[model samples]
Target: MNHWDKFLAPYKQAVEELKIKLKGMRGQFELDSSHSPIEFVTGRVKPIASILDKASQKGIALDQLEEMQDIAGLRMMCQFVDDIHTVVNLLRNRNDFEIVEERDYISHKKTSGYRSYHVVIRYPVQTIHGEKKILAEIQIRTLAMNFWATIEHSLNYKYKGMFPADIHMRLKRAAEAAFRLDEEMSLIRGEIQEAQAFFTRKKELKQEEKN
Candidate 1:
């Protein structure tokens, strides 16, 4: 295996296992017919090119890439702003992973108006050789926040962190709109949850009839 592949193998394993575990939590809530704070879980190991770029940008030595905390990243998307907090609490209560640090960007947003709850964690993965501890980052955000952040990320790539005045202003405005959308959704979260539960029950009844 290439050096990058060999180095990233443990992180990849960590992401896969964590994705299953986190998704299982949602499954449990579904089986109980309860509202799950987690909408979906997605994960990825950083691409070698991106990792190199980040390391260079941060003046991190390539040999010391282990210091790159987010090389293995997982994102937990939520339906409402409050759901973000729920997911964060769930992570805090978990024993399989040790949360090393937390960055609450939602309350104190970035200058670019990025908003997400970042939790850095150290997780152990059992390998053929031995147990390896891998650092991973879990980013919890509402769907609206994720949408905005995705767009902003793409724009950052295009602009290379040098956005024009107009584009910068528009991005800021869009971020505000996204945040407002989350707030509006939260206001009707109870009704939304009830509607979802109703549909789930209807679907279950249909399945029973088929059986």
Candidate 2:
């Protein structure tokens, strides 16, 4: 248990630091009274059991666990599909970490009907020993896409990957529906942003009046 904790310490640190940094980007946009491409950020270090299962499934030796990019994962949710590209560009411009790879799952969705943009990065973490570089995966998706994926993930857990035929077909349909919703929302992006900005201003005014 101690060994496992020591091994994952850096990964946990990396997830925490990256979440704060990414959320700070959203804060900067808010400070400027501009729309932030990032709606929210969430992160996690894969559980030991899940990590072991994935390693075994992929024939990745324990010594080569670092090769598994998603052991430390972060999810950045955007309001619109276009915002995903904007966030990806921002990530590319940052010097804090090196992006090792990118997978455009939104354009080339998985066979199982998953859609998201995956960015694998090598992040440097400082420890008592020294600085260690670790692989982490960031998934960018729209709110609608996330909603569909979340349900699919839960179903995957229940079915253990071999979903019933009907369930599988329904999931595929749901994925497409989610994508269409994103497209429709994108068409009205300007209106949505304007309304949200107005709501925010109203809330700020109410708070100021209380103070």
**Could you give candidate 2's per-residue lDDT for residues 1-211 as a string of tens digits?**
9989998999999999999999999999999999999999999999999999999999999999989999999999999999999999999999999999999999899998899999999999999899999999999999888999999989998989999999999999999999999999999989999999999999999999999
- Using alpha carbons, what is the TM-score of model 2? 0.98
What TM-score would every model get versus the actual structure?
0.98, 0.98
Clashes of each: 0, 0
Task: Please give, for residues 88-174, the per-residue lDDT of candidate 1 as tens digits.
Answer: 998999999899999999999999989999999999999999999989999999989999999999999998999999999999999
Q: What lDDT is reached at residue 61 by model 1?
A: 99
Model 2 Cα RMSD, Å? 0.7
Alpha-carbon runs more than 4 Å astray in model 1: none
Of candidate 1, the 10-residue stretch with the lowest lDDT total is 1-10
Report how far off residue 156 is in candidate 1 (Å): 0.4
All candidates: CA RMSD (Å): 0.8, 0.7
